[model samples]
Target: MCSNVIRRMNEQQLIDGCKRNDRLAQKELYDKYSRKMMGVCMRYVNDRETARDILQEGFVKLFTNVDSYLQEGPFEAWMRKVFVNSALEYLRKMDILKEAVSLDQAPEASSSFHSVLTELSAQELLTMVQELPAGFRTVFNLFAIEGYSHKEIGEMLGITESTSRSQYTRARQLLQKRIGKIL
Candidate 1:
């Protein structure tokens, strides 16, 4: 199909075309989703270069594994999930998943995050999140920013739900401490 024709196609058809190895179709898909998917990748990875790397690899999976996508939801949203999972997987492979300071292992959760959060803008929050060590940071992003439940975060990172909760607590604690320092 022509580039214009490819661009006009809805995502499922674009995905269907990609499964058939249609170059124009895949390019169209990439052009459509890459920006938003990059945002998602950046949230998880917290580094532009690494997030871009994840975005490229995630797109590779999108093209190579297009057949695995279910016809269950919006295609862009599906692709977002794929890229999100892939970003998480990249963190896991890098051995960053186990750093969650278990609540039991961490000092008690403080009300510090709440005290300081209102003063920060969205970008400020993102920066604070980026400053967290990997385990605490990833869980915080998934649960707090991305809206994943503790159970989902646990499953994705291979930790318990309580661990996810505790890690989230610790992440907030760290954010509080760091932001407190900045103010």
Candidate 2:
């Protein structure tokens, strides 16, 4: 298919350039993937400043590990996995991400992220989330935004599932307050 051909060509160029340690190629790759990857970082980090730090760290890992990326499949998925691992690692360092999140029959997400979220600019949404306190925001973003199960959040954060759920509950409350203020 024409799409496959285009993807192959783009990846091939970037892969070859990466193999040669070309800084420009590295920058180009970062430019292309940073936004999505930052979204990953933000899910695990409660602070926008810390999220940016994690984003930068993830890009460094991507650039250095570019050679390790498999040539056979979807590049974005691979990049996402890398960013996710990096975000988890960052949470581990912070010690707060270890709280257990409880799912306990929470309601279904209010809306599909793609549809409900389209109404707000990315910055506005991020700002709304960033307003949440640290522990609450991290759990909320991981569960609500990134679609991680509460059990998964619990394992990642070193907390009980119930705690993750509680944090998520609190996060929702906080977001509601912030949204009300904005309105």
> What lDDT score is found at residue 142 in candidate 2?
75
**Mind giving the per-residue lDDT tens digits that candidate 2 earns over 33-148?**
78778777876665679879888888888878888986667888778767877877876677655444245422333423444455668778777776665677777877887688
lDDT tens digits, residue span 87-163, model 1: 88898799877764544545544554565677778778777777787888888888887789999988888889998
lDDT for residue 36 in candidate 2, whole number 0-100: 78
Q: Model 2 TM-score?
A: 0.68
lDDT, model 2, position 162: 93
Q: lDDT at 174 for candidate 1?
A: 78
Q: Considering every candidate listed, which one attains the maximal TM-score?
A: 1
Best by lDDT: 1
Clash number for candidate 2? 14
For candidate 1, list the clashing residue pairs, or say none: none
Q: Where does model 1 exceed 4 Å of error? A: 1-6, 100-121
The parts of candidate 2 lying over 4 Å away from their true place are: 1-9, 39-49, 67-73, 98-120
